[model samples]
Target: MQESSEVAGSIVSEDCLDEVIQEQIKTLKNAQTAALSAVTKRRNEIFRLMDNCDNLHLVKSEVIILCKLRDKYDESFQQYEKHLTDSSERNTVNKRHSENTASIDRFITEMNNWVKESELQLTADLDRKSLCSSSTTRTKSSRTSVRSARLKEKARLAELMAQHAMREKTKVMEEQELRLKQEREEQEFRLRKKKEQLELETKIAMSQARERVYAEADNISDIVPKDTPSPLNPNVDPFQPQPSDITVDTPQLKANVPCSSSHCRFPEPNLDMQLQSQQEMFLKTQQHMTAAMLLPSIEVPKFKGDPIEFATFMMAFDARIAPNASGDADKLYYLDQQLEGEAKDLIGGCLYMSSSEGYTSARSLLSQEYGDPYKVSMAYIKKLISWSALKHEDPHGLYTFALFLIKCRHAMTNLSHMEVLNHLPNLQAVVKKLPTYLQNKWCSLAGHLREEKGGVDFADLVEFVYRKAKAANDPTFSKFALQNNYSKP
Candidate 1:
């Protein structure tokens, strides 16, 4: 989508404005018409999806797609409304707008209907199934029946767990996509605002230049008004206009004078003003850059004394400010400003030390307490170990687990103890936290890995879980999986 936007932007110019806008309208209309047809054709399949949905997740996905299509229809309709400038254009736009409005309204009505029906059906099915299962458990308690029931219950739990995990992944991916979309929109908005600001500023600059030129025109004429005295003799009556002076006006104040003194050899006001405006804007931009050095964020982020976080903070501080500092005093001042809580208190004693010694001592103390590789690696590992065993249907917990595992792996690599994590106790402890399906995949993969290498490694486990976590999040994966289970209407 961003690439498409960029392509559209690059192709648009003053000369091609009408062409680009028309293309935008045509493309949007085509997409909306296609979406309307799909929704119309798949009405029954959509109903079936809701009927078989475990909850209302599938219904929500369909509604989001519909809402997006409706919004595009609206945007295109609005653009056409804006495009209409004549009576004939107005009639055409009005007709198209009415048609699109009807489509969008219908789309919204269908979405509302889908939500209402799916919610009621899901509630009824859940209650019915729960009551039926409980009744079956009590009535059919024979040994074979109990065994089958247990198997069925286990499978159902696994299915729910898988669903939960997928939902979490989907949520994370969607949020990421949303953020990207917002950033793009913000960038485009800023670009537009900047262009407008420049144009407005240029117009004002030129207007000022014209005013200055016209003011200077007053002093250009040597011929005085009939009642005004000449500069050489204020008491004398004003000089009468000569034939040449009556016909022409000029300023002889500077070297660049006309041969006939009929006109001042003024530079083109428009060209001069443009160059002045560009120079001024460039200078202001340079001054802002110099003053900010780092902007959007001007200061280094503060840090407390968490060993796991200390390494990142130290690297950032060093990279951003340390190299540019004049001496230890500046460095200490910057460091002192950034530290807080335990980190700040830990370096408090070092402030009494003189000059380089104080800065040196404070830095050393910070390093010993919070930048130790062993301590940092242990902290990362402890976090991994401390994670609660993921509940059977907790997708958010699983996502957090994957994120932390990746962080832990990064810390281990930095600590030069990557192999330490693959030890039997550590490896199995983390594995036991995964859901049943993931455990099964791990077992199968571990067995093959052992056969190939004489022992299994933890990287393989991380990679496997990472892949599953990603797959679970992907909406496309969910869509295809859903489609596989049901034919389209």
Candidate 2:
């Protein structure tokens, strides 16, 4: 019974030992699988981070994460390796110890080699990326330097060209000055000669008048009858009256006397007065001629197939007139009188007449009839705006439209905000195509309008818009605004 029990106990121990070896193998295999999964996961994360290496900031952050993962992987792998070695030494008494130890050693060696290769690959990739980044930065710097050099050369060339142009302009100006001086000197010489001639003629006329006066006195003395007695010499003999006693009525004698010579003219005093008046008139005429000469001769630009061509020209001409005079009703009336025929009819009917209450009736008639002036004006303005916006050309049209707006603003005191708003889009479109300064000015005006807490006053807004348009640097617009006193009282 004892022997049988011993034998049974030995078999139970053998079974328990086999079970322990199997459990150890299973645990080792699980650890190895876990470690492999962790390595794979870390490797994938590193690869993802490497793929995005173009972003330095992201790559830097990923590097830190990869380092931590690598550390964790190493720790876990070392722990697994230590556990496998210990399990192999403890199971040395078991027949499967050599196989299990060899397998664990192979796995650990392979994992270690893989870790080293992966780390070396990561380092090589980082070095290559750094080199590439340095090369790209150098290339960019070189390109920028080349572009800057080109720009500088271009600026230098432009400056040289400008200087050359300025030199040419100065030369032309000097030549013009010399020519003007020569012309002025010639005119002065001619005027001086004319003045000397006039003086000589005056002297000759005075001598001739003296001789004629003496001759007339002698004739009167000879013609007087001997029988006629002088009132002052009643006591003396009628035919022997003394020269001192002879009292002649000079005024009556001069009036009744008729000169037989055709060359006889007005008295010397009257002639002198007439000559003085003529000299004054000539001086005035000379002064006017000089002023006209001094003024710059501007060639009026030609317009073809334009309905408002003459009107535009006249408006421009009016603008060139002095602002103070241009705004005067008398001056405008004078200008109207100067016009003749079709020109008179066109400008007078279109602008001058439309400036007052008469235009309202005309507009009303036109509106009631077929051709509305307001509609025509609006259509023209719309066309100008479209042209300006699309081509970024034809500043004249834009300038004309602005001028029209200013005129309308002044003429129509009842111009409403709604009316301005209706034309606001067109105005803005034209403004966009304007020069930078004008665009800025319009923007500033718009901003100011927007900032006003209270609603914009119609009259004030109209005035502001007119003033803004008048402020443009365009000479035509400037002249128009000044002539009409668009912003002034």
Model 1 poorest 10 in a row by lDDT: 221-230
Q: Pick the candidate with the highest lDDT.
A: 1
Q: Which candidate's TM-score is highest?
A: 1
In TM-score terms, candidate 1 sits at 0.39
Which parts of model 2 have CA positions greater than 4 angstroms off? 1-268, 306-310, 314-376, 383-459, 465-489
The regions of model 1 sitting more than 4 angstroms off are 1-295, 324-326, 479-489
Q: Write the per-residue lDDT of candidate 2 for residues 1-489, one digit (tens) a residue.
A: 999999999999999988887787667657655654664565455456444334444544645554565455455544544544466654552334345345444644554454556567768998999999889976998889999999999999999999999999999999999999999788777766766666576566656655665676667556543443335666865576456966777553364565544443334334445545656665676566556555655554432223334345446545654243534454445445544454345444545453454444433432333233454345444454564432234445455555655654543443232254335564555456555655676567767876885334334443554565455435755655466677667
RMSD of 1: 44.9
Clash pairs detected, candidate 2: none
lDDT of 1 by residue, 374-417 (tens): 78877777778888888665656677788878777666665875
The deviation in Å at residue 153 for candidate 1 is 53
